[model samples]
Target: MKMSKAAVLQEYQKPLQICEFPLNEELQPGEALARVEMAGICGTDVHLWKGELPIPVPVILGHESAGRIAKLGAGLERDWTGQALQEGDRVVWASSIVCGECYYCRIKRTPTRCLKRKAYGISYCSNEAPHLRGGYAEWILLRAGTSIFKLPDNLPFESIVGAGCALNTALHGVERIGLEMGDTVVIQGAGPVGLAALAVAIESGAAKTVVVGGPAHRLQMALEFGADAVVSLEEFPTAAVRLEEVRRHTGEFGADVVLECVGHPSAVPEGFELCRDGGKYLVLGQYANAGNVEFNPHVITKKQLTVMGSWAFEPRHVLGAIQFLARPRWRELFAKQVTHRFSLDQASEALDTVRRLEAGKAVILP
Candidate 1:
């Protein structure tokens, strides 16, 4: 009998309790078991730890991951893209599984908004059957409908684990705003999601991309990821100063698009101010309701800015991200973003590193 180790979050704002449990060796009809090789800790996990994002307790916390197929069930013989799946094939799976019967899934055709959606690590409680549903564990059980993509041999694990879901999240945001060629884009925040947005914007043929965020390392990464200019909060120190620099790049007018990837409610007003009148503003980072801010609604009307908020990403977006990473140009920059790693037992430490902004991306090797 095989046993698996996992870090279970029993309480918010506390250390994760490590536990060992028996693995479910038998795969049900369409299910598969993956031996988790690397699992990336995301900003959402930090929010979940602080009790900012409400979720069921006693969950294994990790969603951004890639692994090798350990056991393929009776029915699922191929990957999501229809490639044959065999034991030991490197792969990455989509985080959320939607109920096709939901109104959002069926009527609106926006399955990402499925009312009964269950996400791995976020929605699944460890008490449930097939207990290893999250990447923080040594194994993850892929349920039916979960789209898995086989990784190409040349693509390094750092490329997939580097951007993780942030790439797909950025992909969905760019898709929502319909960013076009030669557009000027200003990306606010230099975290994983922000960096991902910058890379995607540049790849989409934006003439110029300016990144506003801080400390020093993240801003440097923004430059490496192909930002035309970067505004470090260490230098600007205030929203007003940062806005001035961003406006300078946009000339007399503001940026054609402003991506709010900071997730702070207060950043919305700043991002709005950086956008040109009639420009587009895509809120990609506020996937979690961290808090609220008092902003003048008049700005939205006066600027005539097209506002769009992207939630979690769909499987297609993940497919798009994988394709994006396969490109050598993007992979080089993304591979630079992977800055730290820890063992499964060091899950809490990894989360702490991310919470403190100590690393670009932290992954757990189980």
Candidate 2:
């Protein structure tokens, strides 16, 4: 057996250790091995490293990855879209696998709410066999039933990895709120998720878009991504002032829709304030259990708001995001989102960069 080097998280809040595990040269009946190209360091990865989210230890961290097919399982010849698969084809796989028989999957018709979901790079353990299950490694093992997507020859890898899961997640939230054409949208946060939400709002025909939350560079990217106006967190500095700016950019009536992508519980109340009467609010950034905040329910009642939340992206959303990024204009801008790159051994530094909001989108090139 050959060994694959992986940066493993042996303990919480400590630097990831570079370790070697035996590589499975021969895949199982329905498995495929991908030679990892790039792995994106998401904000959730920072939360996982700080032990803020529950995850298996001794794990290879990274979920957003785009790579080429190293090899396919014996007799498995087609991708999820029924595309013929061959060795060395570029691909991107869905991060989570859901049980189809679950209540959320079968009854609720929302597999994103599936309780028994296992995600690559987050749940998979490096201590186990086929340890190269995560993206922060030279290789990723796509097990049986993994939703493998073959990339079009024209779509650049940078576009896929730069948007990464953020685009997929924003797609989920945007769809849930049912953004109307010509709707005025106020998006909270200026990180990858918020930026992606801004892109979606513009693509969805939002008449006016305001992006709130920033640290200068990210706000600039939001503007470049086609935001009508941006409210800098450093300038506004408070929820009251930020809400005032949003109303100013919009009309006397706030916005038709508000998206909370800040990943903080405190963002919820402000999200309500930003929405117009009968407006919609979609929260997608509370991906982790980041406690609760006190919000007045009377606000929802008085505003007659339609508030909803989308937990994470489904396989379809992942495919949609990829196709969206493949467009000529989007392909160029979203690809530029990958501002920082790191080697696999520098996973800890990559995590810190995301934690400190220093990169547009940090990716690991193995």
When superposed on Cα atoms, how far off is each prediction in RMSD?
Answer: 1.0, 1.0
The TM-scores of all predictions, comma-separated, are 0.98, 0.98
Itemize residue pairs with steric clashes in candidate 2.
none
Runs in model 2 with CA error above 4 Å? none
RMSD of 1: 1.0
Error of 1 at 24 (Å): 0.7
How far is 294's C-alpha from truth in model 1 (Å)?
0.3
Which parts of model 1 have CA positions greater than 4 angstroms off? none
Residue range 272-320, candidate 2, lDDT tens digits: 9999999999988988877889999999999999999888788898789
lDDT of 1 by residue, 1-366 (tens): 888999999999999999877798788888999999999999999888888887988899999999999989899999889999999999999999998898999999999889999999899888877788888999998898889999989888889989899999999989889888999999999999999999899888999999998769998888888899998888998888888888888786889999999878888988899999999999889878789898898999999989999998999988898899889988877877889989998999999999999899999999
Candidate 1's error at 227, in angstroms? 0.5
